[model samples]
Target: MGIIDNLEAMRAKGQDSALMRYSLGNEYLKQEQTDQAIEHLAEATGQDPNYSAAWKLYGKALTQASRYAEAVEALNRGIEVAEAKGDAQAVKEMRVFLKRAQSALDASG
Candidate 1:
């Protein structure tokens, strides 16, 4: 079965967790379903506010959807979470995405 099928099975079994939601979000992002990705990623982040990876993906999905302001918010919060967790890689990645989102906002306004 495909990833989504497996994920759906997991969800059907009520196996909801931050990781599960994050995986769903990532899968949706891969499919270019930014809205769906945002929904899952938001749930993931809400379930675990310290989830830097989820925040990163959430920001990226928002950016892909042209929601630069929200992307900036997510990225900023992600950077803080990453810093707190000593996840330098995540912080760096989020910074890059943060800049991209800022640029989009600048260009649009």
Candidate 2:
């Protein structure tokens, strides 16, 4: 009856898509289930490599999980995708997230 239930039902019906996976990832992120979020988000990006939003969220979720190196990687790709897609807002936000990830990476070294 919740968003996850509905989304899972859709997936069970063979309705998989980048959007579906992105939504799942977003919901999992909201629940602070970074591992599940990462899984779905990775799938979302793989399903549609050009999905800037998914890439952004994926980067964010990675950062949240303290996977700084991977966060930096995902954020870099997300910025490139957003730039190509003319998503200036997403690009700006991703840049901020990138800086955070880079800082975390440096600190860990």
Candidate 3:
């Protein structure tokens, strides 16, 4: 089985968690399946609201789907979480992505 299959099996066994969802989302993103990625990433963030990485990936998936407004929202939340956690790197990266989403929003208007 592939990575996704293995991850799904884990979930099937009631092993689901924020990290597992994040991994599944990351794998889906790697496959360019933005919808799947978004779904799992959203769950990841829901499962752990303080998960900066999940929020970042969720924002990225939204951005990839051209959901600029949602991307901005997620990224802003991720930045806040990262800041509170003193994760400078994550905060910086989310800011860059936030800028991209803002630019997309501007261009579409």
Candidate order by lDDT, decreasing, is 3, 2, 1
Each candidate's lDDT (Cα)?
0.97, 0.97, 0.97
lDDT of 3 by residue, 1-109 (tens): 9999999999999999999999999999999999999999999999999999999999999999999999999999999999999999999999999999999999997
Badly placed stretches (over 4 Å) of model 2 are none
C-alpha RMSD of each candidate structure in angstroms: 0.8, 0.6, 0.5
Going through the candidates in the order shown, the clash numbers are: 0, 0, 0
What's the TM for model 3?
0.98
lDDT of 2 at 67: 97
Q: Tens-digit lDDT track for model 1 on 1-109?
A: 9997899799999999999999999998999988999999999999999999999999999999999999999999999999999999999999999999999999998
Query: Sorted by TM-score, highest first, which candidate order results?
Result: 3, 2, 1
Clashing pairs in 1: none
**What value of lDDT does candidate 2 attain over all alpha carbons?**
0.97
**What stretches of model 1 exceed 4 Å from their correct place?**
none
- The superposed Cα distance between candidate 1 and the true structure at residue 43, in angstroms, equals 0.4
User: What TM-score fits each model?
Assistant: 0.97, 0.98, 0.98
Report the lDDT of model 2 for residue 18. Answer: 100
